[model samples]
Target chain A: MARFKFLVAALAAASLWAPGASATVLDNVKQRGVLNCGTDNTAPGFGYLNTKTGKIEGLDADFCRAMAAAVLGDASKVNFVIVTDKSRFNALQTGQADVVFAHTTVKPVRESAIGIDFLPINFYDGTGMMVKSASGVKSVAELDGATVCTTQGSGTEATLAAFVRARGFKTTKVLTFENLEKLFGALQSDRCNAMSTDKSALAAWRGNSGKPDDYTILPETLNKSPFAGFVIANDSRWRNLLRWATFALFQAEEWDINSANLADRMKDESAFVQKFLGAKDGFGKDFGVADDFVASMIKSVGNYGEIYDRNLGPKTPYFIDRAGTPNAMWTKGGAEYSPPWN
Target chain B: MTTLALRWVHRNLFAKPFDAALSLVIIPMLAWAVYAFAHWALVEAHWQVVGGSFKVLMTGIYPADQLWRAWFSVATLCAMFGAGLGLSVRPGRAASTVVALGVALTGVMVAVAIDVHSGMLAAGSAALGVAAWCGVHHLAADQRIVLSGLLAGVVAIFVVLSPPGFEVWGGLLLSVVLTIAVSILTLPFGILLALGRQSRITSLRVISTAYIETMRSVPLILVVYWIWIIVPLLAPDTSVPGLLRGMAGFALFFAAYVAEYVRSGLQAVPKGQIEAARSLAMSSWTLNVDIVLPQALRVVVPSLVGQILDIFNGATLVFIIGLTDFLRAGQMILADPQNSGRTYEIYVFLFAVYLAIGGAITYASRRLEAHLARGSR
Candidate 1:
């Protein structure tokens, strides 16, 4: 009897090695009835868990839901898998996630070496500096002789060094710490006159500070760091599905459609709006998804502006202004322009 | 009474002039630090963030409607724990009183801090605790029955929890489940490796030694990462759940350490006993099974308990593979910019919880060691 039990256990363990391969990610996701969307659980505004709601609610999280809505026709069919900055690409490559919307910056080396295709830039961020309001500094230009602190081994360190050199600030000093907590502490204790990092992170840190009003983020950005979703490289079917799903958010904003009025807009006489909503001659069928994918996605998550307003807009705690930035709509003279739907 | 207290204080704190001076300086600093911490924790800290986010901290993003599954899992665990305690060591009066006091304090704090709905769950847990105590005190069940019941409870927890799949497992629930699964799965493998290490066969000894040495030399995170990345590639058709892969990696890595511990226990067993059994015409299998294995396992129980605690603490590393455990859940809560200022309160709560759990395990292992020693003597 013991020998038989051992045999059974050995077979059971061996069965885990059996090949159960499936088709592409799209088909697997559809068959499984859920989209595994990778995101950062710790990134405020981009992706963070809303403790009160027992749900992940942020711009990147909303985009995950949007992708789920586009593919599965139910935005609630998304299971968020948290990915850290270092692990996001590996997650996609290993097929651990269907799509990653973890505020990854689009870089050439990432695409070429990491072998992952980036979607269109959804949130444009840049290296920026912050200073104490009482210090009487208004912009990066005025910090000529200031000492700046940033986290070590981050792109911000190199960016700060380049910014200081390019601006020809003779006495400006750059100090690096092992992590954000120490850098923030050094800045708070007057060890550094300024702190530099990604603008979004700076805003989040400022908002979390004891007195948010004591700090000011400079308007001048050092360099562009456009954030986007990414997927395993060379799978155009899966890649295009995610890319167009992101583009639909931008298009929905241009078409003046949002979650609140999606139902009414679905009945609009305009052929283009109807097509975009997948009501008439929709693109979902061509993309191997449901015809009403866009409409369902809109009803579930909302347009780009609504997602922004809900997560990072003035009403939210982060309160990052979108005006005069690439994040704003192109019609409003920003860089967020989508290709013509036709 | 005042004079007695003064004498006690003098002996403990100010017996010598140097001691008195050191006490004068350190006492005030310690008092001030304690006072400041208490003021911050009880009077000044915004505990509402913790209260509001308590559910997420306990079970991150677990569907709210299916929360009863988690509660049932907890109740089952309590019953299993009670049965194990009953089988191992009957609670003395002092131990019972301490447990009762701890439960009472926890219940009162839960009632004060949480809303009515959550308070009802706490009340239910308290009721289960009472029931567990009663069952243990009165049942007088057989050891095998209690062990089977505990095994059943583990199965029931998996059945109740796995319907949501491994992806939904998060927070403390994920941590506890992972630790339990890895510890249980590693035991048999560990024993096999230990036997192989001692085998006279060259091939078996060499392979076992190589595996144990290789696993022990690398960091655990690297093992988890390698398994997570390489396993899928090796069997692309087999879509193993990330949690299971992680557990497998953890078990495979820790089994080496467990094997070494068991090997020490094996060595500690008397050579005469094995020779006597062989002289009595007992086969190697019977000798090892009936005599050597039981005595070896008994000798290593305390170390095994310590390893269990280590695995529980090590479950925090799962977050590297994107599975949210207890520590990551706290980080998720702090990630909310709205609750950023409550970092101290949240971290304190996490620290207290880890300390409580780890301390309890250490205490239980010490008790078990004492009990085993008594039996041997």
Candidate 2:
């Protein structure tokens, strides 16, 4: 029995893992003519598949599209793989997808040990709480005996527990659920006094609700979180290329360059916009892409501003204003500052 | 002649006033179901989009070049079922109605499915009807055992032939393959554990008990995760695929339940029968092979059928491991942005498939139980 099992195992291993799954993922994707970029299946501010449009629309979806545009030249030339928190890393490891834009926070445990590299942070967010105005729960400290609902298996659960404990608030209780939608429902149903998750998620959820005024998301960040994107580790070539490609959006936005009026702006010969769009800059060669790589990315998906507006903009149900968030341009006091284009 | 037909109805339906009242209520419910299903299936179903995405619905993201493997695999299973029917009594009118209903449903669906190019679908179903009629017309006793064995083997061979790959596997095909794989791989181990639990030796009993208890106590997800996580940690020689891990988890978890059922069958075998074998100077192995196992298996046929049903339903647990089973594929269709509002349509389609499968399993098990119960007298 053991020998037969061994024979089967050997055959299966030889069939699936040749050299490594990671090495072939990129070429396989290129040959397939669609970048199978991974993204969150249901994160509100990140990757959420819109039922109305039949397309995944969110900030994370934009990042995946941008990556596809950088690699394949067409932003729409991508297939989206829905990755959840538990299987997200495994999906990348097993060659199910080329990269993940699944709102995965960078942790030391994930970066080196789990075999995936984090791209630059797309959304600098932190945990926050939302409460009904009628609940009289003005601040985190004010809710001593109140039950707070949070999504299960997230850092929010632990943080809520620790905060309640350390503050010597004995009457406070924490509740956890598998999904934010259920957690929010719990809050709305008066089963819990407050709902807690990432601040951006809270913003999106509250805004997406038809009765947005019924709830309010507090500005207090319960915990610091940076939602970084990732690709399989051990491929520095792809890593460097993806990182610079993302930063190109930040640089474009900082220089007031967008999809609309890019040509008109480019003819100014400011050298920065020209160099950034790869008119004569030597950066694209360093990344093994065309000289106009960033130009292709911006042209296809538009600058980061345009992508943001289309997905999570104030005009949408989420109605998010990007002007004050850390996702704003560096010159405007947000953290999306890019190193100067040569 | 009209009065005679009325008399027959009165005898069957109005024999009891209570039964007549119940039928009155049930008839409307039945009519409502028929009306609703027929109208939606014909008038409301968006067949144009569905027809266009036929290849996607069937093959998922599986590469077109490798789809031959899936087709061949499916055909092998179909042939096995066809051969299995050769061993049994011809289906009665009730059984034939189910078969006819399935064929008719498929016919209506295919007709609606293709807008401009529905070529051989209705004809293909008609051909299947003819083939099934032929099979039911000719079946034998000795052929039954061979048919069942081949059915099992066909499942095993098809799963193995999936080319050490997952791309050719998707949709309902994935569900059927995983269920069969679990049942086949787990059967022998289940037998061993059952025998070991019934063994006179203390060590074997203790080991078997521990295994059965541990497996039955844990959730299916935990076992699946163990296969994914622990195999890489402990086994230097094996790198388990996600689908294999899923199947192994299902088998290990379900084998315990199957063993208990088998053990009950073993206990049902009379002690006198074993003593009689021993008196004839038969070894334990010979006695078990000749006398004990056959009777025990016969006694447990219904229970084994029940276990198979459980295994079929349990196949859905593979979705967490990222293998697209039927339910997961249904969910994937909903992932299309355009199909978002069509949740009711998609879910109704899934409900129909699951209902058909579940009904068949339950009906088979009940029939087996009725047959087994007769032996007690």
| Highest-scoring model, TM-score | 1
What lDDT is reached at residue B182 by model 1?
90
RMSD of 2: 8.3
Candidate with top DockQ is: 1
Tens-digit lDDT string for candidate 2 (B281-319) = 998789887898888878877777777778777777766
Model 2 residue B71 lDDT score: 53
| Candidate 1 chain A, run of 10 with poorest lDDT | A12-21
Which portions of model 1 show Cα errors greater than 4 Å?
A1-23, A133-137, A260-275, B87-90, B116-141
Question: How good is the docking of model 1, by CAPRI class?
Answer: acceptable
Ten residues in sequence with the least summed lDDT for candidate 2 chain A: A13-22
Please give the C-alpha DockQ score of model 1.
Answer: 0.44
Q: Residue by residue across A7-28, what tens digits does model 2's lDDT show?
A: 8777455323532543544555
TM-score: model 2 vs. ground truth? 0.68
